[model samples]
Target: MKAEKNAVLTGAHFIDGDHAACEGAIAAGCKFVAGYPITPSTEVIERIALRFPLVGGVFIQMEDEIASSIAIQGAVWAGKKAMTVTSGPGFSLMMEHIGYAAITETPCVFINVQRSGPSTGLPTLPAQADMMQARWGSHGDYEVIAIVPNSPQECFDLTIRAFNLAEEYRVPVLVMMDECVGHMTEKVVIPEADQIDIVERKFTKKPPGEYKMFETNESMVPEMIKVGDGYRMHLTGLTHDERGYPAMSPKVQQKMLRRLVDKILLNEEKIRHIEEDEVEGADIVVISYGITSRVVLPAIKKAREDGLKVGHIRLLTVWPFPEAYIRDLAKRVSAFVVPELNLGQIVHEVERCAAGHAVTRLVPHAGGAVHEPVDIYDAIKGVLEHA
Candidate 1:
């Protein structure tokens, strides 16, 4: 795609939040989008369908979420930057394919613009209820990356980062966007082409007969060869060896699965991302992410003004869950308070990290509306005065 002359200002003109995310995906070199229409996330597909044809990219509206996810995997195998966007219900339908992406080590992005749910609790309301689901939704013990963006700019920036991480790790990366960020518009500065850092899938320059599909060198990211590249590569959802052939033998399966998990799990330093504020001297640390972090910020400010030793930690990458950072903060702070749209998804992680050093509290609010700043402020005040 040729760079538009005034493309730097393109995001500025996209007033609709979803359209901004759609334009961001295109600007970030996404060539294929396959998804079913769902509330909140539907606009992403609609926008892509309209613009992709002009850029020589492909856009397919599948009959269902299952087919949409399957099509995305196929597009990725065809060596394009491909993605599927969905809400809670659609995401439920795509779980099996998500596991398929995991086992095949397919590099692709899945955008879940989350709406309320255990099972379609609220189709159009914002909720961070999917936090745990994003990590454990697919089934099995596979490690994956899930990022939460709090605003439209982050929805744009993190979507691009999600693609980069997927290609680098050869794993499915999920961008968790709540209805709040996915539907709200704000000024987003899209970087110029020369200023942007884009990572393409690493491809082998070796001749067709010489290439190995899953052979890993020092980087642990194997050189990807496309399906029709005359490489004779094989891919399957079953456990497979370096050649991409199914390895039914117990030992081969063990080796392949271990490597797949280790490739991301062992590289914790590279995958973990968070933002810390006033944490150094704090006695109570408030932990939050996604849209909940937006609400928590004002509470943190209020606590500070009230002369409470309160601080905040906002996670940029929610999965591969910033355990190390949380653990470190745990040793220093007197207590930890986690506020989310769900009852206790992330609070458990904070509790695990805090262990014996600090007390952990859950300030949860479900689907109907966001937790007000005062609710979080009271939680922090209570934890501090009582701990």
Candidate 2:
């Protein structure tokens, strides 16, 4: 019997990483982009600003990150797919609005071309250091969808997915890319415009007299009505009821809050995405994502060559954390090795999911550059031998 081809074929493209991300967003039907230029991420905005006008799109270089994020939300509320590109410091400034978007259920895309952190640790250097921050940086208990692309092609592909997911869920989506993938050149084949699947937000169909902005349904995502759509809707950062009016009651607030979190949490199966390898009979599993996962690939291969039963789990969806998959892997693996460009962010999640079934270890590295494959190989070998 002949082998069947996988439905999702993985391939790489040779193109400037930032340009690829920009081109991908354009191809994905993004009509509005608002951002403040920051290092590493500047290329993304630069390309978007140059090309947006050609595509009948609006690209604004706002006064600052806060205004940029606000403009993005405004564009989405106007019924257009909008995005903002930024880095660490700019992302810090956008946190409040990120929370606002969460509460308002405004669907927009945020591209964070990550650079060294704390406070501009290394602008040109790559870092997976923002993983935790991407998930928790914004205040509050809302769930946000963040996609980490390991390459330029993924930067493009996932940017499209981010927009699609944003519209489908009516929540803000993030394209989390690091300096290496953002700057590296790779060959990418972009599909024809008609070949791509575009998802638009579910607009309200009820008459103006019957519309309720925050009303929930089976999906928990309310039907959105744009400003001029003849529906009188009120949007607020404060906890609100179905009428979109501010609610002071504790029960209303709790119900609203739970719905906000539940919408994403309960739909984990649809939102969670991951890549797993060699786990049928593995004793060691290396968990990684983004550019850091690129380093992990070779290390896993070397460990296998050295006669160790090893495997890997790469997360394409960074936020919402793919806990179920991790927990399942934890049950079968002897140890979970997590490598990232930070002291210990994702490792905490891995440890939490692994529980007592497997030992979880962190191979931490800070910004200047990525962890060498040899270091990861050593960690994998050490864990396997030690275990």
User: Residue by residue across 215-320, what tens digits does model 2's lDDT show?
Assistant: 8779899988888877767899999999989999999989999998989888888999888888778888888898998989889888899999998888899788
Q: Show model 2 residue runs off by greater than 4 Å.
A: 1-13
Q: Determine which window of 10 residues in candidate 2 has minimal summed lDDT.
A: 1-10
lDDT tens readout by residue for model 1, 139-249: 776888999888888887788788889989999999898888888887776777556567788889999878887888877778888888788888888878888888899
Q: List TM-score per model, in order.
A: 0.96, 0.95
Clashes of 2: 8
The list of candidate 1 runs beyond 4 A from truth reads 1-11
